[model samples]
Target: MRTVTVEDVTIGEGLPKLIVPLVGQTSEELIKESEFISQLPCDIVEWRVDFYEKVLDFSIVSSFSKTIKKAIKKPLLITFRSKKEGGEKELPTEQYFQLYQEIIQNGQCDLLDIELFMPEKEVSETIALAHQKGIKVIMCNHEFHHTPSMEEILSRLQKMQDKNADICKLAVMPNTPEDVLTLLTATETMYREYADRPIITMSMGALGMVSRITGELTGSSATFGSAVKASAPGQIPIGELKEMIETLKLS
Candidate 1:
């Protein structure tokens, strides 16, 4: 798979890149979180905009985006996840697209996370806009209910690739050990066979925590870690995650 280079971080090459999410609800909290994240040994920082109280105010959101970007000095991934996919807020479809457009035009973030299930035309347009501004797009799908069939998982990933996303990410909740295996099997298959770009796959929750640290073996390009609080279930603390990933490194 071809690697994606954001600043000096090259994903899809070595151990899965570590990504920490900032989910603060206020400007002060966000700034404090960013300061803390800046000191962590992480590869990328994601700003979960839905958690911010003032996220709907474009001017404030844009300003905070710039502040967070400057404070972190790492590749910034701005994501306003919708309520449908385990996010904090619910936005109208038009508003959702408009927010992304504004973000792309502002050029404050290094990457943007676009959901895989959004309308095809809007998703395509948003991705095009982000690319035009030199921002990488991470097309993501999250299934909080249960893991899908291996065929369904691969199909979702293939659709992400067809959308021209710089990176493809899938996060699902596994009900059993076999479900976790299904996720890993599909991820490896996609990486080995169909994928030409980086892909990140994980089975969330306690039952599938093993999937988080097994990225190297399964061909996932990046994994999420938590510094202060986890944005998703089963996110290991950054320090512990770092040590564990190092221990599992293939040399």
Candidate 2:
């Protein structure tokens, strides 16, 4: 798989990159959180803009993103997850597109995460715009309901790559041990067969924690870990996750 590099950090090269999501409701809160996260041992910091109270305001959102950009030395991933995708709030598709375009034009982040479920034309246009600006994209899909079969998982992942994503990411909720295995199986298959770019796959909640720890073994290039609070279900704490991945590397 090809690596996605932002600054000096390479996603597909070694151990899965540790990503910490910044969940703040206010600009002040985000600034404070940025300061705190800069001290953590994380390779990337994701700004969950859907959780920010002032995201609908263009000025506030733009300035706040720039502030956080200056505060962190590592790569910043900007994600405005929609409510349908298990995010905090909802916005119309036009609004979502405009907001993302604005961020890309302003160069606010190293990566912009666009959902795979979005309208096809819009997704392609935005991805083209992002690439023109030299911004990488992690085309994503979150199935908080249930993990699909291994076949479905592989198909969905291949579609993400086909859409010209710099990285393909999928997160699912698992109901049984087989569900976790399904996600892992899909991860390996996608990497071995379909992917031209690195992949990020996780089966969420406690039953799927194994997916988070086993990324390197299964060919995933990134894993999300919690800083102060987990932005997603089943995230292992950043400190513990770092220790686990590091130990695994040595062993």
Candidate 3:
């Protein structure tokens, strides 16, 4: 198994973790969010670039990356989620992939998240390009409606692993407590079976909040929380999440 550190925060090896403040669309909003994130105890800071007003402009992203790197010393993960994966934007697939490649080559982000649903050729190329530049690739899948069967979840995880992803992340919507259970069960199963790459598993929405906070128990490498606002449906505030993680550690 390979372990990675972003800004001195080690991920994997059962480390309890925190990722604060999902960034918004506008540069001003991201700047404001960075101020708030600096006040929180977070391990990683993610910029959800899909929300940016000039998302297609590689130069704008490069400039924004410089500002974020200077403002927050934490490890950064840059993501431009497609509309198919529960994000707000709808860029053409080719353009989106090009932008992602450009950011990986020119931006300062430590990690880049590429959705798993992208065409296999494109996904492979993106992963290869990211690796060439020494950037970690997080191959992610998002299910906003409902959790799939444990078998299906494992299949997705394996696919990501086969693609040489440094991390495999899946976020599914849970309609009931049982749905949350399904996600955890799959996380544990994948961890035990694969035991190579790190995996991030979460269930979204109010009903799935527990899975987000306590997923480390089931082998999740990290969890997400809001510093300014949530990118997902059930993200708790950073302060509350920090308290919960502390309590969990003591217990």
Candidate 4:
């Protein structure tokens, strides 16, 4: 698989990289969280803009991106996760595209997360803009209710790859053990057979937490961990998650 280097961190080349998410509601809270996360042992930090009180204002969101970048040493990954995908806020489709466009042009974040289900033209255009500005795109799809079939999982990932995304990510809420297995099976198949770029996959919630730590085996290039609070269910704390990844590291 191709590796994506953000600053000095090279994902997809070693143990799955740990990504800590900041879910603060205001600039002060996000800055405080960024300072704390900078002291933690993780490869990247994600600011979930949907949780921010001023996310709908493109200028304020761009300003916070700059502030958070200064507050953290780790590479920043900005995500304005849509409420359709279990996020805290919902943005109008046009506003959503505009927010990302502003951020890409502002050039503060090292990476950006774009939902895979957005309008095809807009998704491709935003990704291209990020690339032109030297930002890696993590094309993502979240199944918050239930896991899709292995074929469905692979199809989504394949579409991401075709879009020229630097990384492909999928998170599924597994209702049963079998659903977790389906997620892993799709990830492993993608990594071993089809993927030319890095991919991250997780079967979410307590029932499927095992999938988060087994990335080295299942071929996920990174895993999300929580610092102050988890943006998603089943996110292990960064400290424990780091230890777990190290313990399971393949020699």
lDDT, candidate 1, 172-214, per-residue tens: 9999899999999999999999999999999999998999999
What lDDT would candidate 4 get against the real structure? 0.92
TM-score of decoy 4: 0.98
- Candidate 1: regions farther than 4 A off: none
Q: List candidate 4 segments past 4 Å from native.
A: none
**Between candidates 2 and 3, the TM-score winner:** 2
Ranking by lDDT: 1, 4, 2, 3
- Over all chains combined, what TM-score does candidate 3 have? 0.95
Model 2 regions more than 4 Å off: none
> Model 1 — which ten-residue stretch has the worst lDDT?
98-107
In order, the Cα lDDT scores of the candidates are: 0.94, 0.91, 0.84, 0.92
| Best model per lDDT | 1
Q: List TM-scores for all candidates, in order.
A: 0.99, 0.98, 0.95, 0.98
- Model 3, range 1-251, lDDT digits (tens) per residue? 78876667778866557887556678887787787787788888888888888887987897779798767778889888889898878999898888887788777888889888888899999889888888898889999998999999999999999988898999999888899999999999998887597899999999988887776678888889887778889998878887887777634
Residue pairs clashing, model 1: none
**TM-score between candidate 2 and the true structure:** 0.98
Q: Over the stretch 1-251, how does candidate 4's per-residue lDDT look in tens digits?
A: 67999999998998999999999997888888999999999999999999999887898888778889988988999999999999998899999999999998874999999999899999989988898888999999999999999999999999999888899999999998999999999999999999999999999999989999999998999999999999999999999999999999898
